[model samples]
Target: MNISNYIDYALLKPSATEHEIIELCHNAKENNFYSVCVNSSYVAVTKQLLVETDVKVCSVIGFPFGAMATKAKVYEAKLALENGADEIDMVINIGFLKSRNYVSVLRDISDVKSAIGDTPLKVTLEISELNKNEIIRACEICLDANANFIKTSTGFSKGGATLTAVKIIKKTIKNNAKIKASGGIRDYETAIKYIDAGADRIGTSSLIKSSTHAHQIRNTKIYRKYIETIQKTTDSAKPNNTIKEKEV
Candidate 1:
């Protein structure tokens, strides 16, 4: 598996500098990553940097915390689209979901999806905050809201994506929507676990590592095994070989 094509190279840290974003775009272009996920403010610059490249620009809305008003989130999504973001990942209203106000939760997501039209919205459920049933319900709500993807985390949550969470999401989604497993996926082994558990995309910041660190990743047991498998087969469409690993 090349693995590079499924990645959404990300640099969403509040402290990320313009130089870092430039480096990120360069790395993504070099690796043929699927997209570069970033904060809304940097979308325009990222879009410009990745101009004429196959790499897409994705922006997050109501990140980390989803306590913002629905209108605010909608406005943010619109502004990001205007800034040239090709995809949107929005945090679901955790409070409303916990409050059992399904109507408001549905409205929050549907409104944003409505505003974005067909722009491919991925609703971040922040799975760390929810129980198994909650996770299933969130997947259903995302489907009703017409979200294109059900993301597992914002990577700033108390926990990151889990194998169990991905399984639950996959069971609930049943191909209705895709899954993006983000947070704490630090190595090729962990990334494969998520993919095996039914994740369509893996999101992490490890892919943006230094050259030395990148060498270490390439040498990891799972990565080496992947290389061996690639050399042994010409078929590239194997499910295991086609999953995405985004740099979040």
Candidate 2:
């Protein structure tokens, strides 16, 4: 329950090399950032690197874009798990969601969840493209699909997580599912503010830099409070077995 607890410290990049991934995973394991988020292709290597550590291997499915066929997403999820991914962060089909094709969205999430079984699923809602009402509805759809978490953005969007969006998502989910605020969160202050606004997880590429000096104190305080709140909420929501944390 410290600054370490709130960070999912992402390392997502389309151009990341194997050597970079190895180094990144090593550093992530050393620093004890909650988890290391990476592309599915590196799940095997990441698993190998994080072997004995508590740091999990979080792989993205359907990646920065979620327009893939549903079957492809399901296959991708299964493959990632088979390769040692502990969690799957999948982007929702924004096109489908915006069109109000709720059934397709629900099915997409449900299929991936079923493929992964107990492995946690964090469905990216791409908040920047969603209106307030759509954001609320997306949260409801995610919950109804039995998604474990609702994520804010893909970091490829026009904008990323916003305080207002996080608040609305929290209100819609109401602790039934957690929220992950990703994209454009570069500093400790911005990350802490999101946590205070009710984000259970933070996904940012600036993990190392953000953990520096003055802001560290604030980040620690906010993250600890977030974890404490999580413990209490999880205690009442379901059994410990059901509260697995997903990175990415």
Candidate 3:
């Protein structure tokens, strides 16, 4: 599979400058990445840069941490959509989840999803902080709340996506939801492995690299491997021809 198909090609750095955001959006447009994920502060700039292109602008709400007040998260979502963001990646409240406050968790996600209307909502589960049971419950909660995707981590967590976590998430969600594996996916191989484990999208900071010859290469061999693995894992996970084939 082509590597680009599996990548979201992220640029969510807090210190990104206006020039960098502009260049990044242009690269995404030219390269056809699935989307360019940025902080909410850059949403307007990113939207402006991606004006007429098919490349989508994604902004994070409640961002690296999911401890913001419910109203804050809702307002953030509304503002992002108003600014032309095509998708919003919001972090789940791990604190509430661990406390068994399922109601709050569900309501938080639901409120934001509702606020966005038709825009896609990806809820970051931060899988590293939770156990298998918690991960399953989180996926279920996201599904119940009508979240569009169950993202693995915030990249600011203690650890990022794991093969085991991705597998469990896919099995628990059972294709009812898409999976996004973020953080620690630095090379082409790791990216492919996550996809193989059932990640529909990959979030990483590395996209372009200058090779020894000084030519820029959009290296995503790692991501390609992850996709191949995802194909295999997904095939085995499904019982029959009942499973829908994912687009490459």
Candidate 4:
């Protein structure tokens, strides 16, 4: 399916060393993936490495968990943008969403959107924590807030992306926003199903692991951080799916 263009090559792991981050950016540029998603701390280096390439630099804000105050998130987003981040993937305040504080949730997303101003914000809903109605409401809020994408999970949570969830999300957004099916899409087949079901982008660490040249990384021992952890199944691993949890 040529998932390359639709992939947000991720490396959001706490244990990810500087060398691995550099290699991640270099490989992304060579593979022509849509973008390289990393924690905000590594955004600068990733951007610097991929400056001349077409790859976009995506930085996560209020990562893993989304309970940070709105002001803190805005500041974080601004700093990421200042550091050359082309995209911002922020976790939605799940606590607020679960508490039915839709207004706060919308405002949080809107404030960041306003700060970034067309940088393409992807709001991670952490779908596993919510019910069907909550997921739909979150989509509605994201659309209202003008978010560019509604990401399925953070991979650090209980579950990753699911086809049923994607379908439901697509049905909810109804072309207002795109769906980024993340969490656990390791192999080609699983990634394809998410695309077919309605995912616009596929976030996985499995690209390098599933590629014909996956062995190329073996000699370098570059796949150590995620040899068997983080991604539950080998079917849906993204480029840099690490289970390191950093709650805000």
Best by TM-score: 1
Q: What TM-score would you give candidate 4 relative to the actual structure?
A: 0.84
> Pick by lDDT: which candidate is best?
4
- lDDT: the better of candidates 2 and 3: 2
In candidate 2, what are the lDDT values of residues 1-248, reduced to their tens digit? Answer: 25666677777788899998888887787778889999888899889988899998889999888999999999989999999998899999989998989999899999999889999899998888889999988889899989999999989989999999999999889989999999998877788889899999899887544446646777889999999999999889875565667886
Task: For each candidate in the order shown, give its overall lDDT on alpha carbons.
Answer: 0.88, 0.88, 0.86, 0.89
Root-mean-square deviation of candidate 2: 18.3
Cα lDDT tens digits, model 3, 105-194, are: 999999999998888899999988999999999999999999989999999879988999999999999879999998898876677788
lDDT of 2 at 160: 91
Q: What local lDDT score does residue 186 receive in model 4, on the 0 to 100 scale?
A: 86
Pairs that collide in candidate 2 are: none
Candidate 1 wrong stretches, greater than 4 Å: 208-248
Q: Considering summed lDDT, which 10 consecutive residues are worst modelled in model 2?
A: 207-216
Worst 10 contiguous positions by lDDT, candidate 4: 208-217
Candidate 3 CA-lDDT value: 0.86
